[model samples]
Target: MSKNTLINILFLGSILFIMKLTIFPQESLGIGSDSGGINLVPFRTSGYIFLHETFIKFIINILGNIILFLPFGLFLTMRFKKINRLWKCIVFGSIFSISIEIVQLSIPNRWTDVDDVILNTLGTAIGYAIYKIIDKKKMYLQED
Candidate 1:
């Protein structure tokens, strides 16, 4: 990524981080009434599916979590190209999630849950994975 791209990503990431901190404050903190509890089932089975409820909720939840920190991953990746490795991604994601959890714990309306950290890390990994796939594809195309 170029300097301009790095700057853009940082600027956008900051904006997104702030927006996330405010807009879905409750959900982000894993405290909202609608923030549903964590299900032990790895994947929802057919029996668990409700007629009115779409499986898309699972997808939406996963995607929303992944998307929430995408800008963070994108910006970090762009800014520190040298450390653009999986371990670094994991560390950054972990730290970010930890920070959020800590903040949530201190906030009045927020409820910090270890589960949220796990979910957030999973989300960060997903975002980083997406970024890697796209970045690699772009590089391959350019090489070709």
Candidate 2:
């Protein structure tokens, strides 16, 4: 969109990136305690549906993760208009998530989860989709 919007997005993105990095610092040597190591816990859809605790946990986990990096995707798309394309947005988002994962793998007290990568990418994609929808609405209103 506009230069002012891009600038604002960049400013926000920088703040978010710094905050996230600070909260989840990278490992010192690319490996950390076994207790905090990455775990490939499969999301149990049945548990999500059947058990009250599992259902609440699943909802919380999904929503929390989705909300975390939403700003990253939003700012990325808003700053780089070229990222409006779905494939480009996804690629950049995936790379960004991967970088965060790699950093987490190195840091102590932080565990690198593949599920986080997936959820983060999904958040990015959802942000892009939201932007697209908003843009389209603006265009339609303008035309009308």
Candidate 3:
């Protein structure tokens, strides 16, 4: 397959993985509830997790959100030249994250948190930085 086709496939798979983790419910996860939860204040959930929750839970809640969306920014930049700027990646990431949080509001036992959007956007920015660094290295090597 061509490079572009491969990237597209990978991106689609990543998106599905994200949806499964965020939207799909699994009873085994102990997340049973009749309705979802919402946290509008920034960092409230994260702060609570950090202060009261276990270290592992904190990592899963905070870092996982960011890592979960890193591929999104990378794939977007790779697939679309129009999203070449870091700010564009951040904006797109925020929109995507906000959409997911909004959807989570309807799913039982799921949570809608502003922190997730912040972390996810940070992840997008990190991904964009990684891409730019790699691209710069490639250009430098090619000129050598």
Candidate 4:
């Protein structure tokens, strides 16, 4: 297959992975009673960062959210050239995260955390930074 086809597969796969993790985690594990909610304030998840836990668990819970969205920004920018702009990427990332949260509101066993949105945005920003860095290098090499 072509490069664009491969990238589209990656993008679509990522979205499915995200939805499964965020919305269907409990049921995926054979558990029930999945109600969801919304958090208005930011940085609420920071408390988890300090909680005493195994290093792996701590990193997975706190850092996983950020890492989860990193590929989102990259793959999205790669697919949609118009989102190459940093602000556009950020706005799009925020909208995507918020829409997920909103959907969770009506679903069972899901959460709509503002902190997730914030950290997910951070991941997108970092991914965008990488994209810009690589793109700049490409321009520099072309000029040489």
Candidate 5:
């Protein structure tokens, strides 16, 4: 009913979504690319390994990485007026991605990738852009 209540709900939803993306089983989902050459195989692998994995899988992986952080940027900017800056959301996304990668290093069967960080940052930027656009539209409409 209140703005704070909505913010809290969004915050919880964001955290749950993030956990779903980052948490993986100790056993390998075997999503790795064995064919090699240019695939979305984590950090060191070549893009050739793309064939080992399906095109749809690759697309989902990339898009999933992006969408995973979208709410983070949106909800963060919405909840914290002070952190509503575009740069701040970008930084937060970067840090969050890096943190996931680092934590993955300690986890079994998880490989950290630079691509995730880049994709996540892009997602955060996009979310912030959406927020800004909507925010501007709201202000414009309110001018009446």
Candidate 6:
């Protein structure tokens, strides 16, 4: 298959994986049933998790949110050159993350938190940065 085609397949798969990870029930993931609440205040959930929760929980709740969206940003940047700007990546990431949070509001055991949105956006930014570095390196190599 062609490179762009392969990237498209990977991007679709990544999106599905993200849906399964975020939208599905948590029992299979071993987290048990979440209380199902909304946290609007930025850093509130993250701070609590950092200070009171187990290290694993902190990682899962904090870092996990960011890591979850990294591939999304990378794929988005790779697939659509129009999203070349960092601000575009941030906007797209925030919208996607916010959409997920909105979906979680209806799910039985999910917690909708602003912190997730923040971290996910950060992850997207990081992913875009990585893409730029990789693209630059490729350009440099071609010029050599």
Q: Give the number of the best model, judged by TM-score.
A: 6
TM-score of each: 0.63, 0.72, 0.91, 0.80, 0.80, 0.94
The 10-residue segment with the lowest total lDDT in model 2:
25-34
Colliding residue pairs in candidate 1: none
| Candidate 6 C-alpha lDDT tens digits along 5-33 | 98898778768878888888768565427
**Candidate 5 — number of clashing residue pairs?**
13
Instruction: Identify the runs in model 6 with alpha carbons over 4 angstroms from their true place.
Output: 28-32
Whichever of 1 and 5 has more TM-score, that candidate is 5
Q: Report how far off residue 122 is in candidate 1 (Å).
A: 1.7
> What lDDT tens digits, residue by residue, belong to model 1 across residues 1-144?
987876676747654674466335555444353432333343342224333457775555555556676666666666667757877877887787777666655455554555445666676666677778888999999998
Q: Candidate 6 clashing pairs?
A: none
Q: Tell me the TM-score of model 2.
A: 0.72
Q: Please say which candidate is ahead in TM-score: 4 or 6.
A: 6
**Candidate closest to the true structure, highest lDDT:** 6
Off by over 4 Å in 3: 26-35
lDDT of 2 by residue, 1-144 (tens): 988777686748754763455345445522232346665564443244346556666775676667666767777787787776878878887787777777776666776676767777788788788878888999999998
Instruction: Look at candidate 4 and give me any clashing residue pairs.
Output: 34-108, 34-109, 35-109
Reference-based lDDT, residue 27, model 2:
53
Q: Between which residue pairs do clashes occur in model 3?
A: none
lDDT of 5 by residue, 1-144 (tens): 998999889978997777655755522434322221222454443243355767877777678778888888888788878887889989988998888778766665565777778888888888888889989999999999
Q: Candidate 3 or 6, higher lDDT?
A: 6
lDDT of 2: 0.68
Model 5 lDDT at residue 122: 84
Instruction: For each candidate in the order shown, give its overall lDDT on alpha carbons.
Output: 0.61, 0.68, 0.84, 0.77, 0.73, 0.87
| Local distance difference test, candidate 4 | 0.77
Task: Judge candidate 6 at residue 33 and give its lDDT.
Answer: 70
